[model samples]
Target chain A: MAEILTAKKLAIKVSICLAVLVAVMALCAMVGTQKISLKKVFAGPGQEPGQNIDYEILVGVRLPRVILAALVGAALACSGVVLQAILRNPLADPYILGISSGAGLGVITAVISGITWKFWGGSPIAVFAFVGALATVWLVWCIGHLTGKSQVTSLLLAGVVINAFFSAVIMFLISIAKSEQLRSTVLWLMGNIIEKDPAVLGVSTVCILAGIIALFSISHRLNILTFGQEEAKGLGVDTAKTTAIAFGLAAFTTAIAVSLSGLIGFVGLIVPHGVRLVFGPDHRQLLPVSAIIGGAFLVVADTLARIIVAPAQLPVGVITAIAGGPFFLVLLAKYSRKVSWLK
Target chain B: MSGIIEVKDLNFGYTPQSTILKALSFEVIQGRFVGIAGPNGAGKTTLLNLLCGLLRSKAGSIKIDSVPIESYSARKLAKKVAVVRQEFVPVFDFCVAEVVSMARTPYLSTFGFESDTDKKIIDEALEMTDTARFASRPLANLSGGERQRVFIARALAQNTDILLLDEPTTFLDLKHQVGIYDLLKRMQLEKGKTIVVVTHDINLSTQYCDEILLLGADSSYQYGSAKDVFSPHKIEKVFGVRGFAGKIGTEKFFLPLGKFAKDAHIITTNINSTTKK
Candidate 1:
């Protein structure tokens, strides 16, 4: 009887919080830099008496940017949850695993070498980033598996080494790049989601949605995996296949997010940890709640980023780093004893 | 197909030459509580892993109910066998109920929500293990013995016919150790669970287990009824210690005299003198 009540209460809480988030997002959409009235926002395409200007700024500029922030935030948080569960470490994130560096390298390669391709109206940068992320994940898995068993310590050390090496290579590429390419690369590496292209937004939306759905589908297997690989296998999880699917989808979502915006850090690491602290570690609830909260959190952060400087926006990544750095330190201190990878 | 296991001439090693368990064979009847006992590095845990197909044998075979262990998928095999490991500390804060509910993973859908049936089983498991009171508490807050029982509750929720435990009493206190053995014994008799436990407590095995397999040096094992296998000669020879087996009110125990004596004559005289009593 008590169990049922707690579960019901949690469900009610989540629903209420989601509704509140929707309202917050709506208010934020209205209050950014210029306060456009609902009339102008809904006025459609018109050239009469400031109609086109308000509509373009509200619908074309602000709405898409907000939507893109929500999508990328949800993607990063979901990726964090999956990586942390699989690696059995609280500190495992796309950025920590060298995945973001790998994706950044791919984007730089595309930018400097003038190698471009378009897929389903998404930029060539996203494709290169996705390929790079997947390749790095595969390489890390291989290195971690050299002993025939993928120990958590080995996987973490391999990630650390790969992250360092990939970052150096990215720096080398940045040094030789043209001035325009360098600025673009720098902006991307610092993380910003100013892309106003509807086609790219549409592609990213579909991919992030599909990736979250796929992640939610495997959340059960991920719950078992948190007990570690051997126990998960004993409980009947196909550890190898589940790991592959999870890494693949997480990398795909992260690649899209990284390419859409520059390498945003900490949203993935912080959101899931915050969610776990509040909701406990049942992945069924963890994945979805984290996704929702992550989206809302980023919407708020990006809003702050825009308004903080008044016409000169600070990158959202800067805000997350400032906030999440101390939180990461606290978590490291708390969990270092239990998690060997922390050492 | 309820808990009958057959292992034949299994061989395993991390490397080619350094074999752990070689040419091993054993058969377990239905509904028996068996204990695997040995000194350190006897490959008892390795054998348990092989039984559940967590570790593949380099040679020979293991069959559960006349089917090869490899024939069943990991998920399918989990429906028949559940294992409680010695060491598992979750990195995140999973409450006791949530950890126990993870046993329903094989039965859950892609989204992994627990159904009504899964909930009932989880409740029953928690109640049986006496972990229902701490259902809302984070597992990290529990004491070692309480956490151990919670793990047992998880394995119970798995609802497999065969339950395997690897050193379930490692970090537990004396009372908790006996409590766990008593719980397993009750399940063996009342619930008819086929249990295989790897324990270093030879006395605990002798008091409760229906049969005990004593692993010896050179990848060998001696298997029989507890009464047949717990003799002083076999204990001393296998464990490399001087021990005398004695019974008080039909409950047998082995008391180690000391490490084997350096003088062969003194060892022989001592063994001969103790056996005469």
Candidate 2:
């Protein structure tokens, strides 16, 4: 009876959170660069409808940007939860294993070398970035495998080493790039979700949603994983198989998010960490809650990014870093003192 | 079948060069509280890992019931055998209820929530281990004894016939150690479940366990009733220490005469004689 009541209470709490998210999204939609009439925004074109200034800005510019922010935020935060569990590290995030740097390297090479191939309207750079992410993940796996079975420690170390190596390669690319190429690549690396192209956003939306669902589906197994590899195996989980699937999905979601929007930092790390701090770590609750809260957070941050400088927009990544960096330090200090398991 | 577990010349090693358990053959009958005792390097924990199929043996056969252990699926094997490790340090704050609920992993369908029956079983397990009151507390906040009980409850919630423990009482106070052993004995006798424990305290184990499996410095083992296995001569031979068998209040125990104490006495006598001269 008490268990059922607790389940009901959790449901109520989640519903309330989702309600707040909807209200915040609505508020963000209205308050962007300029206000849009809510009725006009919700009402579709019909017999009495005609193109207007508010309609064009709201539907054309802000809506797609807001949607992209939400999607990318959801993907990064979900990936953080999954990566943290599989890697068995509190500091793990979507980019922790050098996936982002590898993607950045791919994008830089594509832009600098003048590669021109467009499949389904996505820029060649986006496609190449995803490929690079997958390749780096494979390299990490190979290194982890060489030592023995894929121990978490070996995998984490391999990620750290590969991240350094990829960052160096990216730096070399930056050094040799033409001036114009350098400007464009730097903007992409700053991470923006204001993609005006609807076709690219459509494809990435599907990918991100599918990846989030996959992570959520396997979340129960991830809870078992937190107990450690041997314990997880003893509990009937095929630890190797579960960890592989989880890592693949995390990489998949993160790759898609990075390809869509350059490299938004800290949404992954802080959102999941914050969620765990509040909800306690049952991945069943941690995974989806983190995603929802992440979506809402990014929507708010992107809105602030647009209006904070009037006409000129700050990169959403800049805001997240400014906010998340100090917050993470405080969390780290608190965790070191209170969390016995981290040691 | 005379026993639930039958081993035929089982051999295991982490690497090819050194064998941890060599040509081991033993049978553990159903519903027996068996204690495995050895010195520091005797591979007691390794033996428990092998029994639970957490580690694969390179040679020989281990059969659970009539089927080879290797033939069972991980989930199937889990349903039949549950293990309580020495200690667990959780990376996240999981409540006692949540931790115990994880033992239902084998029975739960993929992505399935716990059924009412599963919750009932969990409640019953907590009750059995006297951990019901701590259900809402974080596992990390509990004392060592309390955490140990919670782990036992988790194993109980697994609903297996065989329960294996590896030094479950390590790092626990003497009172907590006795409490844990008492709990295991109660589980075995009252519930008729087969229990296997690994420990360094031969006397406590001998007093509580129905049978004893003694591992020596060399990769060998002896299995028999406690009386046969815990004899003074056997203790001295296997442990390389002098032990005298004695009785107190109709219960038999052994006292170790320390070899280090004799050496210290000789050194002290030499120093005193030289100073007096």
Candidate 3:
């Protein structure tokens, strides 16, 4: 009887996730200029020349944007789930440990120097962003290790300090940037899903997917981690090793996401919490559900960003922050009611 | 069913120079309900941490079933011994059943899903600890006593032969304290589980334990039957309390005593006379 209930619950959760994904996909296709009909959108991009008004737009623009949104969203959300579990802090987001700040700093540096193109004009921004993110994670870990206090509190404090430092550096770079360079940098920092090469999107999608898969594979261990470090060890987890792997995966996913879409915040913080409220904090359920919800959330947010200003196209990051900031404040207010030792 | 744990010349400390346990040695035979009693900073928790491999011992060895603990892999050690810590701050809001099921992690594959056998063990543990009723309730919502029982259920689900509890009754009320002790005693008798409980409640130790280990300062330890080790002299020497041992309804208890002033007798007599008049 209980097994039946468990099966039913699982099915309902999966069905809801699939339904959300489909709904978001539809919204993404329908929202942009030259709206495509659902029938034509799914009918395999009309083959007849010139009769395919919707085909070019669907295949050329909307599809890549939607796919990018899903990939970046999933990456951020999955990173958030792992960080929250490891740090045992519900307030922890993907950027809690300065990954986003580092990525931002790297991009600002690239823009201020008029180095828009990669070395030899190839993927410079993404490469710098990834490297910077990695460096930031490494620095935070080193400081945590040096303190000889590997507790979550110490790691969090280290991240906060590093984030502050990186934020200041980014501001400095912005101040020195030329007008055109500054405008471009501002657009990048505001974060958009515009003009991404399909190949770069595909590569980033694979990276983010791989990181999410690795994280989900350890869902059970993550469940144990929610019990805090000592109990996790007592339950036979190699706490130190598991902690490192979790943080590494989180950094990897966050770096790739930030590389793809410059510094999109709050999707990571919002989606996982939303999933947890529904799914009850079981990472086995929470990770997958958060991924789907996160993907859908970003797609819808991007759709709104495109439509809200009409033709001028506000940055997707601006839309998400506008949507998410109040929600985050509400959550903070709710969680602050009772001061929990674990948080 | 012969199971024995021996700690030989164990040395441990949080810092480099300040050793908490120095050359501390003892042996607990299988199925014994051993209570560890001591005053504050007596290294009771440190000793338990060493036993469970949470803290590495600087010197000596711990052996279970005549095999050295250091020789066993962490997973293997988890299968043999389970530690129930005094305070647990759960970061997520997991159901009681899910929390208890985590004990099967060591026995699980890399994926860590619970098998049918694992489910059976978890169910049995929940039943044993009487937490089955609230299995679906979030652990955060439960009362302190309930949470403690849930943790015990988790330890029980580990299916280990040795169970170490670090001050399990620290925050519990009197009823819950006695209740947990009774549960441990029952498990020891029925399952023949080796139970080592570190507690500041010497009275409970005297009433429930098969044996007691009194930890003193300067790396000294006294171990024997509860009666033999819980004497007033030993209590005073270790706890800096002038106390007397007394019996009330087949249970021994210790009460603090103090020297009398020269006018104490006269004052007592005057009070008695006044009451009589």
Candidate 4:
């Protein structure tokens, strides 16, 4: 709800969220199997870089993993927010657009076919996943456009059909895969955040940040869009243009997240919704706060995944589902009675 | 010829096989209140959509302020005309003021935030619609009529010269229905807006509108002042209901005599008690 929205209030809110994220990230970064002293991370006077075990584990290992999780989390969450608005459906999430399934198929193809391709620090799987996601989005867009019907409904139908088809293909590939290939395929499908490539991490950070900025710029248009396509048009929004752009950007960001960290679940669905409840439905407040909080949430989940099994790390996606499923149920039970806003 | 909204022989349909509006032509003069009434599937909403360019009139022309509707971009047309929907169930809990503030979309760019002047306009809209009291409350917390008023406020905030509404009084209680019409009348008399509403309440439309457009199921219509167009014969012909036409004060009203209206002395054309001095 609106409260005489001012730039100052939004700035203050985002700053508080950013501070919380920093605290959460710091706490999670220190929670791995090896206890890391902050002194080793920064290195006092005579200590050589990466010389200490604590330094190597904290700065070298935990830091990159934490950053990747944060990036993917933010990407998925903000994309979820945009998709929810554009689709005007509460159940809509980043994966509802079929980008994740598309990426999953790509990962399977790369794993089973054993054809490696690399570009700018991207592994074959990541590259394949990115391509698959984008291609699926393009196909969906084409189908939606070709139908020339209700944009939202067409997109949803296309996405669901494509996702179902791809999931079937993925299952088929998994059934016949060699043992090692099957292991890799299952691992990617479950989602992981283990990128040692600095270029990939840095590039992903820049892309995710840019995507979030783009979404923020369209936040006002998005607010109107949530009120159905015709109503948005009644308010003078170019519903077609806004939906296409928001859908594309959300898909792009989701694709990036999926490529970098396999098929992580629920952060997008849970984070935006929770943030909306607390911050109200204003996207100007919702987008940035959800991104920061979403990032922090996954970092914590990833941390728990790492420490729960000690040296044997669980895929971060497994942790998210194990955590997210119960949290989502709780949210439904508590808020189902209160959601009187819609018919 | 001085028409703010001029639709000439408009024809439309969701599909080519199922045409809804057929060769419809009418003009709403600027600064007047007009009502469009028809039975279900009579293309009343289609007409409104055509006027707003939400639906293209494949075989005809709709002009706003003497310019073709297609000549202006959506944003540009929205500056001259605003639309108020029956209800807004946006699936999110937007506050009254926030929902109203959304009317400022055409005025603001993608990169532009609402300025103080825009805020003042929103406040004024809320004030005009009498929704200012609950401006901070979640829209879901409000009653149906209150929610309708909030949408009216949103349209008012658009500050357009023309306001078009589709079944604006649907599902509202009698009081809120009258309240919405009163507000619309005020919008015409005070703000100098050209008003058009599609409504099922033919009696209320006759009371408030300067002119009435009675649409028939067979692509025919009657456009005249309420006294000229809203007769017992036309009402019965168009709506398939027996109508008793009478006057209360200066405004004409209709009474629909149903098949099972109940054998009560309550059914009266007794204009004496109901008529006001």
Candidate 1 achieves a global lDDT of 0.82
Per-residue lDDT of candidate 4, residues A13-85 (tens digit): 9999999988888788888767778876677433565467787777677888888888899999999999999
Question: Which stretches of candidate 3 lie above 4 Å from their native place?
Answer: A1-12, A38-51, A116-123, A326-343, B1-3, B257-277
Task: Report interface Cα RMSD per prediction.
Answer: 3.9, 2.7, 3.8, 2.4
What is candidate 2's lDDT per residue for A123-181, written digit by digit as tens?
Answer: 68788889988899889888988897657888888889999998999899899889999
* Lowest lDDT block of 10, candidate 2 chain A: A1-10
Clashes of 1: 0
Candidate 2: clashing pairs of residues = none
Q: Which one wins on lDDT?
A: 4
Better of 2 and 3 by TM-score: 2
lDDT of 3 by residue, B1-277 (tens): 5457999998888889898888888999999999998888989988888888787888899888899887877788889999999756587777789888888889988645677788888898899899998898777778889999999999999999999999999999999999999999988999899999998888899999999989987678899999889876677778876544577667778655445754445433332232222
**lDDT at A329, model 1:** 71
Candidate 3 structure, TM-score to reference: 0.92
Which run of 10 residues does model 3 chain B get worst, by summed lDDT? B268-277
Please provide TM-scores, in order, for all candidate models, with all chains considered together: 0.92, 0.93, 0.92, 0.93
lDDT minimum window of 10 residues, candidate 1 chain A: A1-10
Docking band of candidate 3: acceptable
Per-residue lDDT for B34-58 in model 1, tens only?
9999888989998999999999999
B1-277 per-residue lDDT for model 2 (tens digits)? 3227778898888889988788988888898989999777888888888888888899999988868989988888888889999786687878889999999888877655688898899999999889998788788888988999999999999988889998999889999999999999988888778898998887788789888999887887899988678776677678876644665664567666565765445433332232122
